[model samples]
Target: MNWIAALPMYNVTPELAAHWRALLAHVGARLEPWLAARGDSLALIEPDEQLERFWLRDDLLLSQTCGYPLVHALSERVRVIATPAFDIDGCAHGNYRSVLVTGAHVDATTLAQCQGLRAAFNDDDSNSGMNLFRAAVAPLALGKPFFSAVLRTGGHLQSLRALAIDRSADVAAIDCVTLAFVRDRLPELADGIREIGVTQSAPGLPFIASKAVPAEVPALLADALDDAVRADPALARRLKLTGFVRRPASDYASILDIERGAIEQGYPVLA
Candidate 1:
């Protein structure tokens, strides 16, 4: 059967997208001999489907997805492969945080001070943009809406733009990895946006394989990714990828816990 793969989570810019493509090429190269040995052949293709739909495809040999969606929407549909460990601030041992950003001119120094302002989030299903942001603001909400309005920008870059350029929103929670990419590749977009705070850390996005793939596929993919990174220290550093960590599905439950904590605080939603 033909197989497909994508690493869609952190492609924040064209340059960054190119970098991910290069990394994928290296990983695929490392996996070729091993997969051929198993009577399996792999193919790399740019995915055209919406991310969630793409993840659920039967031929989705490999991909990476957010933890919130992993627990809520994709738990049983996909098999966990491994989480990439990044040697970047706000991340450790495959865990990452959301950086709460605001326009540099905004005077609000804390969440409480930002109450009644409009907020932007990538999507309701995003762990970094929504779940973690909600969890951070829940205690300060006192069971009421914290932001006067909430805007779903559909992506972390859009959320950052909402804060930095459009000025339609006062603040946003952006994935730290996305922020890192913007700051490194497209520094201008990050120029006017300043990180005011960060949310509690959770496991980073997990690489996954189609449920139909044999259990050994995930292990093999993980080994190939490690080998690829080890072979090119420069590529690994450029991507901020330190290593890969094989984790069980249970490890992502912490993302759900962060949401539940907010719900229990009576601020079930970001609004």
Candidate 2:
């Protein structure tokens, strides 16, 4: 039988790698007991593979994915399992927001002042990294794009580096919950970044399963996630997770709406 597993959206820095492993391990361990009870075992795939490539594959029993790709990219390829509730700034229940961040020394506070500056995004398919930030800048785009150029940093951590270390970008949008973790784990790195604005809250990343997975798996996974948060003190403390909530697909429609609204407004892409 094929194995099933879980993965985060992207890799983390070396310093925080162990913490991520522990969190995923905790979730995987919590899930397996229940999965085994049903004659299904949840395996933890710890490859360095890009998550976006395998998220829709047949063996993708469970994985966390951003809302942007969930709507614009994956669509019906995966079924929603449950949304993780995180205790982070700009997050309530399972809805979370993105932060427009810049180098701590940049004196400009308003988005308009930073016009024509370089902007970096994690990926074109990211909600917090791209779409919402695009919408955030759409009003300022007018007839011209906001940044003189755009850089595809491939990951939020890369975008953070572009702003704080490389100095290649004047601004970037980061997931608030991810920021919370980085700040908690890597305070010195976090100190180099500062938020100027925040995107509207959308549903946080949802755990998804490939259509091939058992239909009853979602309910069991949800129960396991809640149990982990309530019972796994280490994981709960590290992730600041409250619980899991089942948010309808409609909860993510607003993200697509934002994308459409931006496109129709003559700002097809982030300015």
Q: Which stretches of candidate 1 lie over 4 Å from their true place?
A: 37-40
Q: lDDT of all predictions, in order shown?
A: 0.87, 0.78
Identify the leading candidate in terms of TM-score. Answer: 1
Best by lDDT: 1
| Native-referenced Cα lDDT, model 1 | 0.87
Error of 1 at 15 (Å): 1.8
TM-score of 1: 0.96
What TM-score does prediction 2 earn? 0.91
What range of 10 consecutive residues in model 2 has the weakest lDDT sum? 10-19
- Each candidate structure's TM-score, on Cα atoms with residue i matched to residue i, is 0.96, 0.91
Candidate 1, residues 6-71: lDDT per residue as tens digits? 888888877777777777788788778766777776677777877888999988888889999899
